[model samples]
Target: MKRISNLLIAFVAIEHILFLIMEMFLWQTPFVIQRFNMTEQIAKDSALLAMNQGLYNGFLAAGLIWSLLIRSYVEQAFKIKLFFLSCVVIAGIFGALTVKISILVIQALPALIGLVVVYLSKPQENYDVVI
Candidate 1:
C-alpha cells in the first residue's frame, strides 16, 4: 500500500508536468489542433490563451505537490486531490460531450489512484493527555 501510494503521487506529478507541456507549448500547435479537432486558424490565433489555460493546470499540479509534502493534513490533502480530480473529471465530461479527444483514461487514471490512496491510508491522530 505504501509503495502504491508513492507510485500514485509520482504518477500524478509526471502527468501534471506533461499537461504543462501540452498546454504551454502544444496547445496551439498543429499536433494539438488535430488531436483536439480544432481549426488550425483557431490554434494559431489562441496560443497565448492556451498557455493561460495551462497555467491553471499548473496550479493544480502545484497543489498536488504541496499535498505530498504535508502528510499530517491528511484530510486537507485529500480535499486538494479531489479538487484537481474534479477538474479532470469535468474536462473529461466536456470532451465526451463535445466529441473531442477527451483522453478520459489518462485523466481518470491518476485520480483513481489518488482516491485509492486516500481511501486506504488511515489517519493517525495524536491525542494529548493533560498531566
Candidate 2:
C-alpha cells in the first residue's frame, strides 16, 4: 500500500512538473494553446498569469517530491505526504469550481487515491522484522 501510495504521489508530482513546463515554457505555443483551448490572442494575453500559475504547480511538485525524499522518519514522511496531498486536493477542488471540471479529475483524483492508500496503509509494518 505504501508502494502504491508513493507511486501515485510520484505520478502526480511528475504530472505537475509537466504542467509547469507547458504553462510556463509553452504557454503561447500552438500545442499549449490547443491543450488549454485558448485562442492565440487569449493565450498571449494570459501568458504571464499562466507562468505564475505554473510556478505554483512547480511548488506543489517540489513538496510531493520532498515528501518522498524524507525516508529517515516514517511518521514524518506520512505526515508530509498527507499534508501535500491534501493541499493538492483542495487546489484541485478550487480550480474545478472556478475554472474547469476536468481539474477535479486531472488534479484531485490521483491525490485523493494516494491519500486513501496512505491512510489505510500500515506504515510500521514495513519495518517489522520477522524473527
The numbered model that scores best in lDDT is 2
Model 1, residue 75: C-alpha shift (Å): 5.0
lDDT per residue as tens, model 2, 12-41: 999899989988999999898888789999
CA displacement after TM-score superposition, residue 111 of candidate 2 (Å): 0.7
Clashing residue pairs in candidate 1 are none
Worst 10 residues of 1 by lDDT: 122-131
Model 1 local distance difference test score: 0.67
Model 1: how far is 29 from its true place, Å? 2.6
Off by over 4 Å in 1: 72-75, 98-101, 126-131
Residue 58 miss distance in model 2 (angstroms): 0.6
